[model samples]
Target: MMKNYITKEVLPFEGERRDLANVAREMFNRKMTNVAGGNISVKVTPDENFSYDEVIYEKGHDYLLMTPTFMSEAWYAKLNPSQILVIDLKNGKKLSGEGRLTREINMHEEAYKANPKIHVVYHSHALNCMFWATLGQDMPNLTEVTSVNVPLGKIKCLPYRTACTKELADLVYEELIKLGDKSEQNIFLLNSHGVLITDTDLHSATEVLETVEWNADIAYKQAIFKKLGIIENYQSCGNSLTI
Candidate 1:
């Protein structure tokens, strides 16, 4: 019954299928998810054949598809597309029963509404992002790498709210708008929560999250080495080369 429901109305595309699997694997391998910690979703394009006002482009088709919650990231990596829930955004209906739609579905909805260009949303409690959040530090654009990706814009922080509350949704919506005309690649730190990463597609979205963690890891390690007074002279280590 669960398998039948999940596979019922999903659109089959090898690219999207592979993307989903890759994201799941990467998240697990990187320990982005400890046990069952994060969720990933991809938005489906509305069908061109359907009229603008039509509700059902096709009975079985879904506007969004997501992985099941509570499954270990490693376990989720092995799940078939049929094991994920297919959600109809038009009416907030779930066409599949493999698992209930995540309560944070509103987060994805709000992000999509704010930025039509975003096709993927990833929410994870990454250690580095979380460390900054816990310290209540604004994620600084200190280095070229951090500035290039996260940039110099403010890292919007949403206050603690119930995971699925209307307040939480509203906060995220407002923050995105507050980002204003700046670069759309800003990363938002959810206070006492997790990181909300959105992007043009699943692959890019995953990359953005990876970059954030990478920067954080680098910063943390550098701070530790500095405390130990172990800084090495990079100029002395190698011969200079003209570019």
Candidate 2:
């Protein structure tokens, strides 16, 4: 069952769906996820003055605004504000928007249940991130940013859990709660599925998304080098390749 926990403060959503579209497009353009793969969401306190079909909403109540689950081929990249859904996470109710959310919503809810500070979540099927997930190993830190940013050594690659199941969500929730407030470590590599990241804002969430993938790519290259017996000496990535 969906439930609400301690809320730090009410941050009502002020922008239109296009605001979410910008980030979603960025992830898509960067080849972070397939057209229908990743999903993005944000928790917000509904505006008291706003009403749905004549029913007014309470300002302090938390609601999730997210993208549509099923979309036409081109719609994923050209997402519109009208395509976003606003749902009441408390009782699993839909407040607005057309179509259902991605099955990954369960994991997103679990993240919110674990930490009140998290306001946004991005789950993508990025190639590199998913590559690490299949191995069930901590991503090697060839770069300092990956070590410090994904401070848990590497992004946690969750064990095999069926997508949309309570077990999957709970594991992700518990894993994140243990980290306390390190929202950047929000990255979660789902076993045989994909990746998830929780953040207080879109900016920081997007920032780490690129870094994690870069680290994963670097690790892949290192593995290849080791296979070919290129070099045993340390190859430090002194600068961030987070572009």
Lowest-scoring 10 consecutive residues by lDDT in candidate 2?
Answer: 3-12
For 1-243, candidate 2 gives per-residue lDDT tens digits of: 733333323222436466887778777888888865678888887444454453345667888888777532447666766667777889767766767777778888888988888898888888887788888765666666766644535467788888789899899888887888775346878887888888888777777788888878987887777668785543655642221
Deviation from truth (RMSD, Å), model 2: 6.3
What TM-score would candidate 1 get against the native? Answer: 0.74
Residue 30 miss distance in model 2 (angstroms): 1.5
Error of 2 at 105 (Å): 1.7
C-alpha lDDT of candidate 1 relative to the true structure: 0.64
Where model 1 places Cα greater than 4 Å from the true spot, the runs are 1-15, 46-62, 73-76, 149-152, 181-183, 221-243
- Index of the highest-lDDT prediction: 2
Candidate 2, position 186, lDDT: 65
Q: Which stretches of candidate 2 lie over 4 Å from their true place?
A: 1-16, 46-48, 71-74, 148-153, 183-185, 237-243
TM-scores of all candidate predictions against the true structure: 0.74, 0.83
